[model samples]
Target: MFPNNLAFISSNQLHLVQSSLLSMLKGALHYTIPLTIITFCIGLVLALATALARISGIKILEWIARIYVSAIRGTPLLVQLFIIFYGLPSVHITIGSFPAAIIGFSLNVGAYASEIIRAAILSIPKGQWEAAYSIGMNYSQALRRIVLPQAVRVSVPPLSNTFISLVKDTSLASLILVADLFRKAQEIASTTYQFMLLYVEAAFLYWVICLILSIIQQKLEGRFDKYISK
Candidate 1:
């Protein structure tokens, strides 16, 4: 009779873990995907512009871009998200949680990836620039045709690492009342008083997602290797 009772408890515990994982993963699929995708896309664009600005040889633009990069890198992302989501409302600049999360993450990514991009662009041989000029190509034409293509090949690995990190970071959105995987897990743990189990479940989902992203990153790097070796 005691053995039967122990077996029943073990089965229930397993059931709880399974259900919690499924619930959180469902939220990740519905909310996390969109947040990560939008943030990365916007961040990529902003990062590229910021990178170009830093290297464009214009004092004002370079100064502003430098300040932005410095500020974001110096601060933690949580404080940044808090400023956007909480502090802005005091100034009557109202925004929703999801959009605020997207903005915060984008700004962070912009600051970090800009450095990666700038370094990659600088890595191109100075002779490439001379060759472009010798061929009567303007800076814009050379950048669009030759420089950017090779720079992109060099930047792919680090940028892909950034994107994967963004996937896990999206969990922070839950703090701002966004219904992401971590938020769902928080709700479940609060009701059931199973914080450890539910959080572990959420972590499992994040791990699975990151694993997939890593595999995709490997494939992309392999593809880019062809261009890099030439």
Candidate 2:
């Protein structure tokens, strides 16, 4: 009876760990990747527009962009997530939790990335702008063709790092019921009474994903360097 009991306990523990791992991986696929990609893509667009406005000759547009960035960067993401997910619905403006996560994250990313982009654009010497204008290109044309390409190269590393950060940050979505990897781990741990084991395993999975992303980031940076060298 004692041997049988020991075997049963070991098997249950193993099964619990295995299930936690599997569910976390599944959640990563279903929620984490999609959230990161969608938020980053939308945020990049918003950032680009905001950055341009910041640098544009128009004072009003610059002021508005500044306000947006200030507001976003000044607040906690957790609070922003709460307001978007819970607060807005009180005013009869409804948004689903998944979309609320996306919008909240996108706004956060946009504010930070806009400054990165603006700095990258500013890093290009003023001579480049003059040279383009001298070649009969308007401000818009020069920006579209010449300035942006150089700026993109400068911005790539930081933006990629931000993207990796965004992946980890998406774990916060669990607070709003997004059912991401961390959330899945929470669900498993709650049921199995194995919080430490499951939580550590989930963290290990996050580290693995980040590690893979870091490798890819290095590769991308190297590729960019190669192009610049050529």
CA lDDT scores, all candidates in order: 0.91, 0.94
- Which parts of model 2 are misplaced by more than 4 Å? 1-11
Candidate 2 C-alpha lDDT tens digits along 1-230 = 56875546476777888877878998999999899999999999999999999988799999999999999999999999999999999999889989999999999999999999999999999999999999999999999999999999999999999999999999999999999999999998888888877888888999999999999999999999999999
Q: Which 10 consecutive residues of model 1 have the lowest summed lDDT?
A: 5-14
lDDT score, candidate 1, position 9? 44
Give the clash count for each candidate: 0, 0
- Residue 98 shift from truth in candidate 2, angstroms: 0.5
What is the TM-score (0 to 1) of candidate 1? Answer: 0.94
C-alpha lDDT of residue 196 in model 2: 78
| CA deviation > 4 Å runs, candidate 1 | 1-9
* Model 1 agreement with the true structure over 1-230: per-residue lDDT tens digits: 56875546466667888777777878888889888999888998989999999999999999999999999999999999999999999999988999999999999999999999999999999899889989999999999888999899899999999999999998889989999999999998898887877888889888998999999999999888866687
